[model samples]
Target chain A: MGRTADYTNERCSVAATLEVVGDPWTLLILRDAFAGVKRFEQWQDRLGVARNVLAARLKTLVSHGVMETRRYSERPPRHEYWLTEKGLALSPVLLTMAEWGDRHVYGRDKSPVLFRHKTCGCAFHPVLACEACGQVVDRRDIERAGPQDLTAPTVGEALDAVKIAAE
Target chain B: MGRTADYTNERCSVAATLEVVGDPWTLLILRDAFAGVKRFEQWQDRLGVARNVLAARLKTLVSHGVMETRRYSERPPRHEYWLTEKGLALSPVLLTMAEWGDRHVYGRDKSPVLFRHKTCGCAFHPVLACEACGQVVDRRDIERAGPQDLTAPTVGEALDAVKIAAE
Candidate 1:
C-alpha cells in the first residue's frame, strides 16, 4: 500500500497481469467462466461469493476487455458473461496454475479433477515449451534479457530498450 | 472470505495453490526470488514492501515448504530465502502469467523483459503442450474429466471419483 496503487503501467508483465487477475476470487470467476458458467446467479451460487464482490469483479473484467456481455434474454434483460479472445488466451495461465497445483499440492494421481485431451483422450498436464525450439522448458533453461537482465548493459542501454519496446 | 480462509485443504488445486501464493505481494516476492534476489534487504529494496508484510510472506512461504532458509552470514545469523524443488516447480505458473501480460497488456514485441531459452538462445514464448501426447494443447482440445466434467455423470460417480482421487 506504500507505493502507488496503479500497477497496470508496470514494465513487468507478471505485475501487469496480476493487476488484472491476481485476486483469488477474480481468478475463481475466470475458472468458472472457462467451465461455461455465464449467468450471474450461477457464479454467485457456485463461488458462494458476495453479490457486491462478484458484481465488482465482473465489472472490472468487462472494463479490462477480458469479458464481454451478451443478453441471453431480452424479455427480462438477462445477460451472460463470456470470455473475449483476450480472456481465452489466459487459458495457459490458469491451466498452468492448475497444473502446478496438481503436481505439487494434490500430488499427481490425487487430483480431484483431470484434464483429458479430447483428441488424445489421455489425462494430461500442461508442459511449458519454448515456442522457438519446440523444447520443453526446464527451469534451468531460461534467462532474462532486456532491461531486467541479470547482467550487462551500456550507458542508457536499459532505458533505450524500454523506450523502444514501448513504442 | 466467508466460506473458509483455510483454502489449503480445498479440493481444487488452483485454490490450494492460491492459498499459498495468491497474494499479489507474495507473487511479486516469488518473482524476485526467481530473479535471484535472496536476502531480506534485497527483496525489501526491490519491492518496497513494508517489513511486517514481507516478513510475514517469507515466513508463510518457508512454513509451506515452498522455500527454505540457508544461513548466509554468521555475524548476525542472516539467512537467505531460496526456493525449494516444490517452489521451483512453480516457475511455469509465474512465467505463464508474465507471458499473458506480455501478450495481452503490453502487446507482442513490447515486453519490457524477454525470456531467452539459454539452450537455444532465442527470445521465446511459452506454449502449453499436453504431456501425454506431445501435441501442443489447444483450448478446443481439452475437456474436464472426473468430478468436474461439464456433463454426464452417475449419481455417486462424481463423489466417488473425488474420494478415490483424494486417496
Candidate 2:
C-alpha cells in the first residue's frame, strides 16, 4: 500500500487512461453503452451494479467525454447515454480485451460473442500496425523515444515524429 | 458496487479477461516489459512504485502466463520479467488505451508513439471489417447473435455470425 494511490505519478498514456476508466465498473458501463443501454436504470439493470456507483461512473464518463448525455424523451427530460467519438475510439480497447478474455478465460466454451470486421468478413483480430506501413508488428521492432524527444527539432516535432513501428 | 466483480458471472469474453489481468498494476508491469525494462529494480525505478506491489503484479502476470521470469545473471540469482506470446497479444489493448489517453488527456500536444505499417509506409488505423464482404463496419450494419443462438437469425448477417449483440 506504500505505493501512491494517486495514479498520476506514472507519466504514461496507458496509466492515464487507467486512472480514468481502468476500473471494472467503468469498462462494464462502457460495454453496456456499446450494447445500446443508455438510461441510468437500464445500465443498473443490465450490469446489476449499485445505483450509486453507476451514477458516479456515468458522471465521471460524461465529464471526461468518454460518453455523452442526450434526451431520449422530452416531457420529463429523460436522457440516454451514448459513446462520443472519443468514446467510440475505445472500441479497439474493449474489443481487444474481450478477445483476450475469450481465449484464456473461455477456453472450453465458445466465445459467446464475436467481433466481425464488417469489411473483412472474418473474425476481427485487433492489431497494432504502423500507420506508415501496413505490417503486423512483432517485438524488437519498436524503439524507446521518450515522451519528449531530445533533438534539435523542438520537442513537439520530435514527439510528433515518433513512429515506433514502421508507420 | 452492485455489479458482480467476477467475469465468470457473465458469459462475455471481456468480462472473462478482466477477471485475470484487470487489476491496476498488471498491465503497467506488462507495459514496462514491452518497453524492455525487465529487472525488478528497473521496473521500480521507471514505475516509481512500491516494491511489494511490483512483486505481486509480476507474480500474478507470470502465474497467468502473461509474463515469464528468467535469471538475468547467474551469480546473484537476479531475474528479469518478460512477456509470453499470450502476453504479447495485449499489444492491441495497450495501443488502444494509449491512443485513448493521447486523445483525451494529452489532446493535440500529446500523440501516440506513432505506429507505422512496416509494409505500407503509412499510418495504420486498425479498422473492424466485415468477414463476409471485407467491408468496414458501422453500428447500423450488424446484428448480434450470441453463441447460444436461441434467437432468430436476421437476413442481414453483414456482421460476424456470433451471438446476437445483447441489448
TM-scores, all candidates, are 0.84, 0.76
Cα error of candidate 2 at position A67, Å: 1.2
Per-residue lDDT for A1-167 in model 2, tens only? 01233455455667767867877678888987888788898887677878987888888787667788998789978888889887887876887787676655554225667655544455655545443343445434554343433223322232234322115
Error of 1 at B24 (Å): 1.8
**lDDT (10s digit) by residue, model 1, range B1-167:** 11323343346767767766776688888998998989999988877778988898899888667899999889978899999997888888998888887777766646678888999898879998888777877888998776653342322343344346546
TM-score of 1: 0.84
Per-residue lDDT for A1-167 in model 1, tens only?
Answer: 11323344345778877877876588888988998899999988877778987898899888777999999899978999999998999999888888876766656745677888998889878888888888887878888765663342321343344346546
lDDT of 1: 0.76
Model 1 residue pairs with clashes = none
